[model samples]
Target: MHCIGNGGFFMWWWIASAAALAVLIVVVLLSSVRVRLKYYREGENDEVDASLSALFGLVRLRYKVPTVELKPWLNGIRMKVAPEETSGVLPELDFAREEIRRFVQRVRKLIAHMKNYKRFFADTLKHVHVVELRWDTRFGLTDAAETGMTGGVVWGLKSALLGVASRWMSFERLPSVTVTPVFNQPTFRTEIVIRTRMKVFRIIAIGAMLVYRVLKRRGGWIVWLRVLLGRSPKESTA
Candidate 1:
């Protein structure tokens, strides 16, 4: 019996030894995995070959272009001045703010990813720069209907029908322009009138639609038909 017990004890000791050895091998192999590096830097002003230089050339090609001025204006009588600088700057400011916000978000995500991988960033990361562009614009609109046509020798008369379309409502007239600064980086302030006929129609249509849906839900087909026909149920009965 003693001999049997001694044999079992030796077997367990050997098994434990083998398990420990296996674990040690795994740990060593894991620690041996070194990050693969493409280049090493030992000195400043090191020359890069054509291939290496081309790798970073995309930055230059993708740089943003500056817009000196953007002016969208509506003047008296529906006369439009071809692309001039005396308009409004509010829209441009809004666009710039949105762009900068997105850029910052992207950079933050990139940094987080690098941190996750236990990686180091290039030295170029330190010199990142963002530039903003400013602009001045003006526009005019007149009420003369002018037209030109085509044939062997043809011409068309175009009349300024300011009241004819929604676009003309923008030319209601601005006696003088005023600008006031609002929140955010460069600040935005401008005085301008929104669109006319279209805006009014849009509001009325939306309100009517909402009322129609509500009535239809409560009264079913009877209310819906009346709404579509531009008549109320009470009016139809009368």
Candidate 2:
């Protein structure tokens, strides 16, 4: 009778452990999910505010990016996550803070690169004034012709800017990010926020479709078999 009791207890323990593990996995996956985004623009300036929530709103992240002077002029990023939200999932607060710092550094580097590119382009155009003048004289263009040429140049520039904007707006580096815990009593909520210009969900969908197509064409069964065997397809069969 004691042996049977012991067996039942062990079985219940195993079931309980599996249940807890499943719940933990679900919480972790949902905790940093992008939930909402709000965008506002005032003349040449724009701002984007986004929120990320986890565990059915038990954990939340909020961030704001205020583009003060426009494209290249970022007014710095402000992000905060509540401390209560970091209880079980996050191991340490220091690690989370360091991660946020690294992200800010990356943003600064990108901004600097953009500013340098703008300066270089402006200088190049200044140097080309003589060439532009020569072209104008050689063409003997009328006012209407000059206006058309200017319009074409402006259209090309607008298209190039749009292309760059589309690529930059895709948050390829960090899709969902968890912020460090802010210990203030009034604001003790774990937050994970992601603000992006382009529709990242759509991009992901398109990428997944492309990957599926490639895998299907290359024999999806072989790929699945290799994944189950814990071996890359490029590895030798031997």
Candidate 3:
């Protein structure tokens, strides 16, 4: 009788431990993933910094892009220079009309993907909460009228972005914004910071939804693979 009682007690203890572990997992999964983003462009330099955390700061991560340089190119196209020093291993790069065509095709494919996956993304992003947002911009041009027009365009862009955010996510408070135009000088600068959060469980659910959506269609995996490769299967078929 003593041995049987001991075995029963051990079995109950194991069961209780298992239950406790499951609860902890659920709690962690339900915890919010906090995100912070900062992006800035001043004169010839721009960079982006981002951070993410979850489970009440038990998990944390950060990413930063130091800076980017841009220069005027032929045909009014701007050329991007890597922030790091060049290795000098590769030859000078050139762009042909074919490259421009390819870029346009890729953009079209991206738009199509957005249209197809609109529901999937909406379902995922609806769970997000906007904690804070601020965007400050200063721009100048030789002509005062041009500077004024540019500032208005920037304001419109900000308003559109905030409208989209409000449509998809819950906002804790109104966002702050500022735009200043300097007509006497020729310069451009902008800074943006935003904070948001979403539950880990919601993210998991979104992943599940993606998988289900992909599996539901014929040749979906192939299409998905092609999409990841920056090409469409129909392009290959043609």
Candidate 2 weakest ten by summed lDDT:
129-138
Order of models, best TM-score first = 3, 2, 1
Score every model by TM-score: 0.15, 0.29, 0.72
Winner on lDDT between 1 and 2 is: 2
Best by lDDT: 3
TM-score, cand. 1: 0.15
* Clash pairs detected, candidate 2: 31-54, 60-191, 61-191, 61-192, 82-189, 82-190
* Candidate 1 residue lDDT tens string, 1-238: 4455878988999999999999865544333111111111122211111111111232111111123233233211111222223354312222344444555654443333232222122222111111111111121113112111111111111122222322322233432222222222222222222221212233344445444444434344344455356553344221
- RMSD for each model, in Å, please? 28.1, 20.6, 5.3
**Model 3: residues >4 Å from true position, as ranges?**
1-4, 70-116, 142-150, 225-238
Off by over 4 Å in 1: 1-94, 116-119, 123-238
Candidate 3 positional error at 113, Å: 8.2
Arrange candidates, best lDDT first. 3, 2, 1
User: Considering summed lDDT, which 10 consecutive residues are worst modelled in model 3?
Assistant: 75-84
